[model samples]
Target: MKRFLLHLLFWAVYLLQDSIMQFTWTMSALPGMPDGERIRLAIIATVIIAIPKAIFTYFVVYFVFPRALKYPALRWWLCGETLLVLTALILAHRCLNFYIVGPIIYHNIIRPTSILNLPYLLLTIMDLGFVSGYAFTFKLLRMQLSGKEREKNLLQEKLQTELKFLRNQTHPHFLFNTLNNIYALARKRSDKTAAMILKLSKLLRFMLYESGKGFICISEEIRIIDDYLELQKLRFNERLSIQFHRNIDQEGSLLAPLLLLPFVENAFKHGVSETRFNSFVHIDLQLQNEILQFIIANTTNEDRIQPEQIGLGNVRRQLELMYHDHSLKVTNAAQVFTVQLTLNLQSHAKI
Candidate 1:
């Protein structure tokens, strides 16, 4: 709404000034163009000239100017060309108006010799001043808009970073919960529970201290998953099978922190606890054309209910907010769960 008003203001000022200048041109022509008919003709001529000027101004300011500034040579050329065009227009204003309107009025209003008079020059100078002033203000408005746009993007990124930090905190919370379970069992002097706690603690340290960064390497994420699977193996007593299959071309691909763990957590919430025996979790990763692809699937017992309440419902919303339309997919069946995620990784070849 504010943008609409500002646009209206710009058009109003341009149109009002053009109309007033043309009307004044007629009024100032003493023994020249007549009052009524002359004013109408003057307005028509002004409209004809000003319409084209307005179009040119918009194209130059919005399109050409943007490109011009990108190259120093183009920028200098355009500035010089603008000054030349404005100079020619001011000098030709009287000649154009007098030659075009003189015949229609005949000898009654225009004295032919005095048709190109002082009044017209003064009016042209005033009109040019208004145009130049509008151009300067228009450029200033664009500059201010660019600055404000930068600030808006910066603020948005800051908010997202803070939100991501809060979300990442969830991983440590989950780790502590799992560790507490293992610790409880260890207190009972269970040998398996003692080893599970050790593995869990190692994974937790990496997740808490190292992978807390905005992104982590693919190898590091795989290592964390391996450690997590080891901890689960101790807990489940070798009744569950987990496999990691990585066929990606690169080893150090990057991913957002804790993006994959939720899927594994969901797998455990239902796949391990509910399924009586011989459950499986399979994970795969591949990269093609600088796009990272991740796949995770787990078998669940038909009698075991789906873990609908485990994942953060808002995580999907957060991804949409952060990534907009970038690729991410997840599907869950009564006896199987699947998750697929793809990301456009930065590469020099593309640039």
Candidate 2:
């Protein structure tokens, strides 16, 4: 209904413009006529002439424009056809003005001239072309806007699908590492296996429920990291030294779920688990003024470090997909591997 009203408004404006032009032309041609009679003739002539203009305008905008876009090879043929139809409509407009409107206004039968009066025919064509040009410009603008909207929607959908896929990859990669720890404890018949299983259950519950959300409170993610560290502690005991320091000014800040876990998990998998000697994993997290900074440094035995682990790669892609205003830096030197990530939480807070 709103669209219909807009179209009605456009046509009303066009008619008013045409009527004014006609009134001025008639006033100049018939200077002796009264103002009231001149206005009536202008309005009657405009109304009668608008019929062919409307047909030609709609035909060019709706019919010819779409076919030209769809079939480029037939453009010349379409152009010829359009010219023929336009000529026919111009003749119809001339005949209607001469036979129908002339007698009504002048109260006398008018003599017919050659239907091929080049000057008058050209004037009619110009009149029809004026309105057709407006209609075509409007149609082109609408089509361009609609195309941009569709492209934006498609890009959004593709981003979401890729994010979901990355999350799915993180879930299993995390699970496999934790389950291996549990399996090792089970083989030894260690009493800590049951406690680890309980902690694993809680972590699984969080992953199943909270991880599905696009964003969650920073505190929730901290809690998940705590549970995971405790589960790892049960496996490694005093052999691994783990330190977590947090200086959070805002506990309720929101960020993408499961975004931080992969770094911590990477520290454990490549640092603590691979080392035969004592190893240390230090994590520092700070959130102030909606900016979150996370740094994780861990000891590694290998001389050369491979930072692109599957878990780290997945988290890197997730970060790219979820946060536009975030940066991640990875460094390896002197038997220590480190990952530093900084995020602008406010950018994704509303997502």
Candidate 3:
């Protein structure tokens, strides 16, 4: 609407200027037109003449402008096309003057000096007013749009950087704590310490390779979670309880690279590992119809209260950024920590 109004105003200005030009030429050609009565007559006549041409010119410019241009070689093409549009306008003006308005309009009652010959002067001013002005306006609009695109891209890149940094932080925090446990066993020369190292290496490989990317297969995330649970189980021996069930109906479920792993990792990190004896974590991932459902619940020990948001805070940020208003449910109590995240993997985008 604004553009339409602006175009209307632009045409109004051009028509007013064209009328003035005609009035100036007319008064000089015939001195009788300078008197008040004759001047009013010329104004009325000029308005009738220029108004329609101005409205027509506005439509031509608005509808006929082209885009989708790229490359230095194509610059010449645009320049040539622009000239052609202007030249066409000039020819249109001449045709309107010589054929339509001239012969039919100012037939016998109108003096030859009274009707200004717009066609004669149109070619001379075509380059100055028509092509150059329009080309300049087009370049100006293109530059403004380019700035907006640049800002959008910069914002996306910033979010990605923050996400990666957050993921990187989660990796080291998990490893630092795990290595501390392994270090304790290594000092005592425990046999299980070697197995722990191997498990840790596999976890590191996952974090380094697959998890580092923008997205990952859901099956891959589950596998990594299993590896983590198995490693933690070796440390706990048979004292720990775990239930992990996944329905293969959504076999090719796709998600952000490290989406579910962080939640699972957080569950075991704070939930099961807080107190030594008989703690449990329940994990479920399945696809019913087209919806992907993931749930995690872990027993939290009140007596050995851990910081509520160690790994969970960053994971929440990542989830919000990756899947804005999708579907996420989280419940945490003194005794139990739970996360129920539902994502339509069919709607998930490949990064």
TM per candidate comes to 0.56, 0.90, 0.62
**What lDDT does the true structure give each of the candidates?**
0.66, 0.86, 0.69
| Model 2: residues with Cα > 4 Å off, grouped in runs | 29-44, 105-116, 349-351
Clash numbers, per candidate? 0, 0, 0
lDDT of 1: 0.66
Best by lDDT: 2
Better of 2 and 3 by TM-score: 2
Model 3 misplaced regions, further than 4 Å: 1-127, 304-307, 347-351
What TM-score, to 2 decimals, does candidate 2 have? 0.90
Order the numbered candidates by TM-score, best leading.
2, 3, 1
> Which scores better on TM-score, 1 or 2?
2
- Candidate 1, poorest ten consecutive residues by summed lDDT: 342-351
